[model samples]
Target chain A: MKHNFGAGPGILPQEVLKQAAAGVLDFNGIGLSILEISHRSPEFEGVLNEAVKLVKEELGVPEGYSVLFLQGGASTQFAMVPYNLLPEGGKAAYVESGVWANKALKEAKYFGDVEVIATAKDKNFTYIPKDFTVPADAAYLHLTSNNTIYGTQLQEFPASPIPVVCDMSSDIFSRKVNVADFGLIYAGAQKNMGPAGTTLVIVKDELLGKADRKIPSMFNYQAQIDGGSMYNTPPVFAIYVSMLTLRWLKAKGGVEAIQKENEEKARVLYEEIDRNPLFKGVCVPEDRSHMNVCFLVENPEHEKPFLKFAEERGIEGIKGHRSAGGFRASIYNALPITSVYVLVEAMQEFAEKNK
Target chain B: MKHNFGAGPGILPQEVLKQAAAGVLDFNGIGLSILEISHRSPEFEGVLNEAVKLVKEELGVPEGYSVLFLQGGASTQFAMVPYNLLPEGGKAAYVESGVWANKALKEAKYFGDVEVIATAKDKNFTYIPKDFTVPADAAYLHLTSNNTIYGTQLQEFPASPIPVVCDMSSDIFSRKVNVADFGLIYAGAQKNMGPAGTTLVIVKDELLGKADRKIPSMFNYQAQIDGGSMYNTPPVFAIYVSMLTLRWLKAKGGVEAIQKENEEKARVLYEEIDRNPLFKGVCVPEDRSHMNVCFLVENPEHEKPFLKFAEERGIEGIKGHRSAGGFRASIYNALPITSVYVLVEAMQEFAEKNK
Candidate 1:
């Protein structure tokens, strides 16, 4: 009965792991353990104020947006979105498209004059770079909407007049978009939210004090949005299991009904890896990746007995990305349409006993 | 029953929260939810290889020390320990003492020629500055062993012909020193390891390629010690609840028996805030802080009825740090000596019912 498809600390939501394992045994009863409380205590300020008002009511996030939650991941917002809004020696732009968008354009060229402009690194990034430009007084363009190790995504985005910033860690929320077309987004709560030491961010309250250096008040996103992310000592049980995986993504029908169950679990595992003749997928099926599908196999020696015949039929983490080898799966937003139907019936029983 | 005196994301260890709430419901059984697996799976590489071999067999840490498990806390190692050990314009030598050792000496003075050399900010820092001089061909001396907002504690660290580094975010492992007398240490796993997106660090393998520049492969501590902290995608359920609080600190006897139960829970709350005349204490009883004690309130209107009588006796995070306000507690290492005897019997029944 196990079937995770691991990518970015992957799968979650068995009632957000039985209410994050009953809030580490107590929490709501407040007998401690939500890793023993206190992110400025009103019981973790009601779990970071109802997980930032359930991400501004499940991502409508407008009315002068701010969010925050922070703690280095999404590679510390690629040097905190160019150290809190570039400014000094300005010029921004970046795009690249893999390995965390060229490691956030090499941490925003160690603080300014960035400008890669656009690149899928000659397609080894597999795709996602059309009509680049965007530099009329550039101080913010950056990208990486999705590229968990070259699976590639961005499906839409592009039309910018400056101010954008993204990194959406691994295809944020996995669907509904337009958080007012960005002015900084961030993500990293270990994919689809709930693990790695939390990182969210959001921002757009006037793109924050226009950076003239001296940032580090914990990488100032206006000092963590004026101390609501409680200035410091956060990462309280990874934002309380990312507020029970955003209240199990607003009781299963929020980000537009979980983007129709994440495009039907990436169209049933990319139509059984494009009609499996021993499989094939690696990006470019219109920049493949509804959350890391990646593939390859026409007999790479049945990749270690098709990952031990899908790990003896429980079908776990699919394995791929020792710089991209043979399988990947991933299906993020709390992956479970019976775990992509047990990974498309274990890739149709490993292509009928190895074709 | 809810007495989490919030120092770090404070307090943990009830058999490491019942084996981290049974590994978020089935990690060992592999039914999944150690936050949905796969940090390069061998079941998260046997949970990051037995949490870096139980921090080198409970901090004996020999053989070219490495450890790592990072994510920007310890304020991103105050600019990744002078961007991976200084150099261009090199210098080093800090020690300022209070607010995060003066924010790691203002981020190692933006990367070079630092030298605060020594300072308790002329006693306003309340103590711990003693005899200075740590220069001798500098490039690494820094300190801050335990000052979670000025409660002070260096209790013996100064024999540096350079290369020391410390931070030990809020007195690491409560007590028991000489992890090969420092050459990098860090701590921020929300005080005494286990939450807040994991920080740890450790270091010292010939301080790795003496940093000339270009870190940022997640602030490269030698690329998280040559990718053993998985070089990226770490912070997996805060390193599996910091390997279930280092296996409940090696079945409760490691770190020299939790340094005699953290010196009998900081000597029964600094002997009831020094025989209470309505509380006092804040450092300098030979540099206090066995792990953040900090106190105050001989009658400044009994500091708002001793923090609303320790938050109506449930005794929560004891307030202080409105830049040194009036009460800190913190007593980390999973805090219980019966929650510092329920915060020194709720500060002696709020000083005998407010004197």
Candidate 2:
């Protein structure tokens, strides 16, 4: 019983792993291995179709929206959002909060004029800015829904005058969302869904083809939507595994149930960190991410010892990202509640031992 | 014992499949599965480093070349090549021969001035045009090393005035080549190497940073190279499978031995097609691809019967692409000599029954 609290390359359910492992050898009793199957083959086409269908069904995607499975993860989508929607010489509004948000803004600058509406960079990205104005003239208001490195999430997606484009990379599929609220939303599959390979881009149909630039076919959301994400050979195995994970999500009662479990897990960890004498929570309580719980150990010496304790206890991937030090426990959708309790136990045990 | 002749998501060695499936469960005895492990983890980094090292070693890559594993298939690279290599307002030369070649040329037009030095469109893409003269002032001379759909291969790369950029997507790693001859070479790993998510790019380091436009980080080869393909979460599973396949290729004595075996397989099948009274070879003998072997049946009615015959004999994915009719059997690196014999026998039986 290992407790893995990894960041994206999402921690998957063990059963999903077993099924994925089985698929590598023979998928659904097909004589050929999934790893060797051609993307154009009927078998893989079925996998692609089912994955698209499940994501739409689970998300309650509206009639006009198209759910596409694309490549290059959230980073690609960062640039692709502007490339597909921002007309030449147009301007888009952006709210920067974390590394990914800044990266998105930087990429957008290449396509068109970008208006920086607001940024939490001044405060080192510890909190989500609630009062940012989106200019009506801007093509779109781009923001990161969840900041993984900063351990923050935009709890309430404030109404924007322009169309909303959200990079929900680390927190998508963990909660229910209003599909109509955003013009486009992209999530790297690794965090809430599957492994690293495909990015799920849900875009409103009417918003496409407005951009004047010659968008690369791979980054052109319209082309991908028209091609059913099979414009080229898709990341077949990754999509298959994503389909399985989505199936698991549906079977466990969809996003609502998963969201409830997620809240409880976060509450337990955050509450423990608040009550425990040896640690301090990093993010502001209101904006703290349920997915990534960042905290610092009191006394720099305890940091090393506690990490060692967790390591010996078989708790993996708790190490914080390089930019944001201390520790980060990314309790994503597939992470079990039991893992949280185990991590809390490690924290308590370490404090007792050192005290 | 399925005779898989699929045109991509490269056919894996039996041992490679078993090992890959096992890695999905427990990678190197690390309690975490490969799919769940973070891309930044030491284990995954090892996989990435080894994959790069093996590819470079096998290709005998020159000292200054940078090998990168990236997401988005060859189609993404179609535009990314010009977006990175061709400076703003500069012209690049291209040889258009097959379906992929036409697509590449079309995409390159968006990035800069594309001069089609020669095209085989007049012949319905049946042959490679060797009479084209590349302009001395062109940024690069881009060409497809092998045409998968038309079954045509460039038997010898002609001297180019400008730097050569080769799209070796369909035939990379199948044969040895002088890496110094090309300024850049990119292959979608699905064909001769890994699965369908990642692309392998080998570029001359000196040629990077010359593009006048600001490239999106995901599409920017220099950024990806500097970051070791971890500029973002790479397709972890794809790279791992690629590494396993690369290891298998190395164990099989690398490219030289595989090339000999590939030659024998192609020769046996080509000879059978040529000798058979009921069939005709499509590609010119001198420019025939060892990877993709296409042919035509004497009687158009036999197409269906032949397809059914191949299916019954457990030969999957032998059906021809829609654009190119009749039949196509892609004997990639992993396709065994025995599979070719089996296919030849099936062809012989079909002709005998039809005749």
Candidate 3:
């Protein structure tokens, strides 16, 4: 069997995928396919509420936070954040790290003034910006927790009096986090959750309804929370699959256990890259992402050959994103540490042959 | 087997559901579940393009129209319509037919002035408003083709000088339309298409980017079209199921054939409701929906007994919406004539025993 390393729509726990597949065929002994069931039905209502409860329990979410399963990915969240928080004549702070961070800042521009607190773009986004201060009067501070493309992650977080917003699209549920430390956290479910259709949002209740602009009902967190994310027909199948994965995570000892396993997977891959004569890790050591480990061949001429070598040995989607063109092996929470060892073996064989 | 007749998330063809369920397990012979694959991959890109092509071909969509599979539901489209087409200081006329039409108007109010040209609420939304003149200066005349809650439908569409926008959430793909006549058409994919999670949007290319306000990237039609609906990771499972359903429709002789069968089903059911001594049709006869067939027991006391009887015979979700309570059997595109016959038989038996 091949190992998958594609970013965003990354790996899922095998058992969760199987259960989700079975659910699509027949949900909870119901003769109808999950895809064909009514969202307003009592069966689906239970599924929705249970999924929300699982996220809250797993995250150890403090009181007064609304957990919602919304559609439209983190990219949509980029614009929606400002639309609901950055009112007219207001200013928000954004940390420009990767391409996604820049995109978020660009969309935020339409709603209000965006202050560039820090940016790592000057160095091809190879490292996270460390020394920067968020404006005291800013509405909220926005940052991407992990830069998927460039293999960089924020090693140090800035403490701000203003509400903090984070796009944890690539790194959510992989580790233990203080849920109350941020005002809002958003993640597209494709990465570590289950699939691509659902998006997770955990927001502090008091921080909403303060925008000066008229927000669309779907984009308004207050509206969604009031409606229990059923203001309109939700992405039910996606949410159902997510619920299954959340259950799997709980069965495997939650985020703290997953975090330890994820660290070992990253350590093995990063160690192999450092030891191999023909390869080197892409990002600075201090800021490397455990979820997505990116590396490159020492000699540019060896890049194609090394990629081919990895591909022939049952590895897929190991090719790096075009913007950052070396190689990326996304070892997400569900991807086992043994796959990392296999990938490391491939790299060592390639290095020996080339030498 | 029980036949489903829920309003929003209605029935889908059994074969389509089976194939879609299989897709959740394995896609295009690939071991990876469709949910586990990357949206940017060639496999999914083909699926998205083919789905769009099938929609255009099936609907006979005009050359300048753009088809987009978006996340969020038609409720999102309600606000997005005005944000993309209705400029600041401009007005748009609306035919307030039922609950959905009024909701559309409520969202549009946030962007510009909304003119309710006519409303059917005077009669508790039991009939379509026949005499209404859309203003020539209005940005667009918006209407909901089928009213799910109140069982009313617009039989006679107004020929307006202004542009026309339609919310075809419940009726899309069930009948052929002159695609070029309307500037935009939006539908939540749960009814006639496939499942929830994806919303289909068909907009005339030239009608976009004319709004005065800065549109959010996710809601902006032009940006979404340019991105080929990959502005962010799409609802892959939803779009894939919709594609399968669209293909099934084409295989079964497209919308013309489906509409013919739909008419016969409605005729058969409406005839039973009229001929039976204990039952009566709900909406005004002329504007009764061919898709959703609504009826009521002549004696209100008979309602509970008939519903319980139907339930015992494996007919679920036949109860009317809470707002208009009698009975609503939604015979959407995928529901069969045989199912309608079964429902008719149930009604006749109830009438025989009750009388």
Give the lDDT of residue B151 in candidate 3: 77
Model 1: lDDT equals: 0.81
lDDT of 3 by residue, B202-320 (tens): 99999987776777788899989999999889999899999999999999999999989988988999999999999998889999998888889989899999999998887878899
DockQ value of candidate 2:
0.84
TM-score for the A-chain in each candidate structure: 0.41, 0.98, 0.98
lDDT of 1 by residue, A172-269 (tens): 87788889989879888888878876889888988788677776577778877888877667778778888888888998887888888888889888
From the highest DockQ down, the ranking of the candidates is 2, 3, 1
Tell me the spans in candidate 2 whose CA falls farther than 4 Å from its real position: none
**What is each candidate's fraction of native interface contacts (fnat)?**
0.70, 0.88, 0.75
| Per-residue C-alpha lDDT of model 1 across residues B1-355, encoded as one tens digit per residue | 5677777777777787777888888888768777777677778788888988998888889888888887767877887888888887888888888878887888777777888878888777889886888878888888887787767788888888878988887778777888888888988887787877678989888987777786556677777788787766777777888887888888898788997888889888898889988888977898887888888987798888778877787877878877888888787877778878877887888788777
TM of each candidate vs. truth: 0.36, 0.99, 0.99
Residue pairs in collision within model 2: A10-A190
Off by over 4 Å in 3: none
Instruction: Go through the candidates in order and give each one's DockQ.
Output: 0.26, 0.84, 0.76
Weakest ten-residue segment in model 2 chain B by summed lDDT? B1-10
TM-score of chain B of each: 0.41, 0.98, 0.99
Report the lDDT tens digits of candidate 2 across residue range B264-298. 99999999999998889897789899999999998
The sequence of per-residue lDDT tens digits that candidate 2 reaches over residues A273-325 is 99999999888889999999999998888888889899898898888888989
